[model samples]
Target: MKHALIFRVVLGLILSSCLSSCGMAFRSEWKKAPVTSGVEGKWQGTWLSDENGHHGELRCVVAAPISRKLAVQKFFYHATWKTILSGSYEAMHTVQKQKDGTYTFKGEHKMPDWAGGLYHYEGTIKGDEFKANYKCAMDHGTYVMKRVR
Candidate 1:
């Protein structure tokens, strides 16, 4: 009976220790922090295409209004290599601060034109810069933005 009791206690201690350590790691990995307000302004930059040699001038406006959502970004991009097709885009993302002080978010951008599919975005905000990977229909690229206003 004593051996069984001892074995049970040992097992309980092992499980408790393991669980406590796991909880600590989880808390550290998902530490909730404040959003950086510096990104709320205008940004101007360029985007380079990975498939073709196409490149373009980009203009973006960011706003962090007081609401349930964290931020909204509006972009006007014009890219030309053989032809010119420029479009204005916008997206809103829920912001979360990462462990490394950078912020990460995921959201969707809807095109204003007819029958245009929604483009999804996932990006990181660090200091005065924001970078995101965007995809819609058959188009995908990285948008690198710097605060200009």
Candidate 2:
């Protein structure tokens, strides 16, 4: 009887624990922020840095035409700060909106070692500019984002 009681108690405890987290499942509804404002639209801008003198143009779209959480983007540039300097560098990136109004931009490129890899941005969208904390696998950079599009 005691063994049976213990088994039932354990099973109940397990069931309760599982049920408690079922409510915590990640749903966009539970996203960190809502009200899609600022940071959405055609954006034409430049990337500048002190680490190395490089200039680049970026075009980005938020709340893309066909999908949610997808950012359509294109960037073309001359990176004099790169380890190897030569022709203009270009790459396409996709941005995905997180519930918190922040975004994740990723692409394949041969630029600064610190500029590649999974990049994450925490954005403050105000007016035509977006200020974000840009993070890469090996480095962190501050972006003074401007909107031109």
Candidate 3:
């Protein structure tokens, strides 16, 4: 009886120690941080190739009233038109920021069908700018943005 009692106590101690040291919690945030009032202004910057072969500029502004579900972005892009079939152009989209610091924005070009399907976005914030980035699966290109104001 004493051997059984001693075995049970030792087993309990070992299990308790292991659980206490595990210290693991569940974390689920889409992004990383929050936006400040000053960083919430228009951002104007360029998109250049890492190889210096191509470049374009973007001018974007956030509004006074930011909705919980949507923000706005306007883009004027000028590409070589090899496959684009056009020259310089203007476009718009509504963006959303998740509490976890992740963001989502959809362009308006494909409205009822795509609804910004091409622009589901993600970005990070630097010193004075919201460094937004979006990935293009078709072109295999990534856009980097900085806050202008």
Best by lDDT: 1
- What does candidate 3's lDDT look like per residue over 86-140, in tens digits? 1333346565556765555555342111112243444554445555444342222
Cα-based TM-score, every candidate: 0.57, 0.37, 0.39
Candidate 3 clash total?
A: 7
- In terms of TM-score, the best-performing candidate is 1
Ordered list by lDDT, greatest first: 1, 2, 3
TM-score, candidate 2, is: 0.37
Q: Which scores higher on lDDT, 1 or 3?
A: 1
Ranking by TM-score: 1, 3, 2
Candidate 2, residue 107: the lDDT equals 51
Clashes by residue pair, model 2: 44-149
Q: Write the per-residue lDDT of candidate 2 for residues 1-149, one digit (tens) a residue.
A: 54564354345434543554422322221233223445455444545543333444433334423344456454332222233222233345565656865655555454333234455555455566665455555445555555543
Ranked by lDDT, the better of candidates 2 and 3 is 2
Report clash pairs, candidate 3: 31-100, 31-101, 31-102, 32-101, 43-148, 106-116, 107-116
Candidate 2, superposed: residue stretches over 4 Å from native:
1-37, 64-115
Overall lDDT per candidate, in order of appearance: 0.55, 0.44, 0.41
Q: What's the distance in Å from true for residue 93, model 2?
A: 13
lDDT (10s digit) by residue, model 1, range 1-149: 54564354345435544554533432332243123365455656777655433467665555554464544433333222222333343466666778888978788866522222687788887887878877766456787877663
